[model samples]
Target: MEIVASVTNASKQYKTGDTVITALQPTTCEFKKNELTLIIGPSGSGKTTLLSLLGCVIFPTRGEVTICNQRIDGLKQKELANVRLKNIGFVFQSFNLLAPLNALENVMQPLLLLGISSKEAKQRAEEALRKVNMENRMLNLPKMLSGGQQQRVAIARALVTNPSLMLCDEPTAALDIKSVAVVMEELKVLSTTGKSVAVVTHDLRLKQFADRIIYVNNGVASENPTEEELFH
Candidate 1:
């Protein structure tokens, strides 16, 4: 019912030498609250470009991006980073956790960067790990955990900030089949907690868990596509 993010006629272009490559065509869409949305496409289909634009990793060449009622496309680097820190959470294909740090410390890192006190960050990190069912492994280093556990820690790190939007890029790509299933289940549970979740993945196995699917093709996006349409 709530609109967590919206892109109004957004498009992205990159200029290399004399060539201008358009990554995404003008598009408008809304990512709703408490829903798990998937942006699916093959390599070079603009899925990553679109995700980058939506996640505030990159701005559009034209149009607007509004997240939690704030326009992000035009924000200065620091301002954009602040908006992303406060409103958006990102998870990547790789777990991206430091090998030396334990799960709790990894989750606490962002909170500390946000100026949250050490004690408070620890408390918040513990709570976040619990949410992802990783409380039992909070003290374990990344090397000691399985791939799924590491991914869950990565997710907890994202959630610890209490951001309204969570963006993931091919989060399950590096996992085994069973780990992928577990991670997908955890992501589904996270979506139910009022956060807007959008993942850009080319993995068809995870498509069954999505509430809505956005198909990107040749730099254009089509929403609510059928599985048959996307797989072929």
Candidate 2:
């Protein structure tokens, strides 16, 4: 398993009137390719902050992050954005789909922005939606779909580009058990097909999907050897 993403002594801090809050302490970690890893911790423990750093959404206040062998800290903002758009896929807790666009159009947006021809973009989008078994719902708007269906559409949008890394933040937060299982099953299939998936979640119920588990506490991380606990 080659290292796909690495964080070396990373930290994020913020300053208020008279005090400085350290949102992340100096932390080091690495994620390998073709594995599903879980970032589990209580609220405010920096799980999301770490994901942002790894995803290149924000630079660290200190230390370095490397993605696909490129040092993100050295890149300019524009360069970083390009790298993020091309190499990373993000699944937000809110199911960030455009309400007005149908499922196929929403999935096609990324390819279109990358300058792919409209015809090619639609072709790829249809293939992605089909991967998640949502081809039948291709023309449904976000509001017309159930929560689980909407989330599957969002997943297809993220996977359409076949990104090197997939970052999912609380992906199953509000879903019922059945819907949660549906999403987790799809993610499991994704990881098996060779894309690296990292999930930031508090829902232990989904832990079984993780090939590796890293528990974050007070901005630090430690390996969870009891990953089998997920199945038990």
Candidate 3:
């Protein structure tokens, strides 16, 4: 499988006055195309930090982050933003759709930001919504949609970019069982279509959909965590 994104000896830290807090320890991991990888851990674990690193939302204090084989850790903010817009897609637990925008408009926002023409953005957004089974709700505003529907719209927005890596942070956290199943299945299918999908989630039931599992605890990451390490 092709490596869409990777972190080598990457770590994150925050300095609060005189104290330094480590959010993530040095860790190396690769997300590959055609795979669904789950980063699982309890609250306060470093999973979210790791996801942020992969998403290029934050720079690693030390070490490197590579997306589509380009090193990003040393890039300027504008350059990093451009890289993210081109190579990465992000799905947040909150859906993050603009309340005033209808489904299609929200999905069209990313492309519009890239200076794509309205006609082309609309065409691509429609196709993306169709992929997530949200075509019927194209004109509905976020307030009018159910949580699941809004999430589907968000997924469509992410997919509209045709990014190589999709970083989802607790995507299923706010969903009910049926909705969770629908969303996870959609993501799993997406992975098989040459996109690398990495999900940071706390739902153990989601393990069934994972092609690879990474466990994080106390700022440490383990590719093959023991049963005790996962549960206790």
Better of 1 and 3 by TM-score: 3
- Per-model TM-score, in order, reads 0.97, 0.95, 0.98
What does the lDDT read for residue 102 in candidate 1? 99
How does each model score on lDDT? 0.92, 0.89, 0.94
Q: lDDT at 115 for candidate 2?
A: 94
**Model 2: per-residue Cα lDDT over 17-89, one tens digit each:** 9899888899888988888999988789889999999999889999999999999998999999999989888
For model 3, the superposed segments whose C-alpha errors exceed 4 Å read none
Best by lDDT: 3
Q: Model 3: what TM-score? A: 0.98
lDDT of 3 by residue, 20-68 (tens): 9999999999999999999999999899999999999999999899999
Task: Supply the TM-score for candidate 2.
Answer: 0.95
**Residue 156, model 2, lDDT:** 95
lDDT of 1 by residue, 1-232 (tens): 9999999999999999999999999989999999999999888989889888888999999999999999996689999999999998889999899889999999999999999999999999999999989999999999999988999999999999999999999999989999999989888988999999998898877888999999998899999777677878
C-alpha RMSD of each candidate structure in angstroms: 1.0, 2.3, 0.8
Query: In model 3, what are the clashing residue pairs, if there are any?
Result: none
- Judging by TM-score, tell me the better candidate of 1 and 2: 1
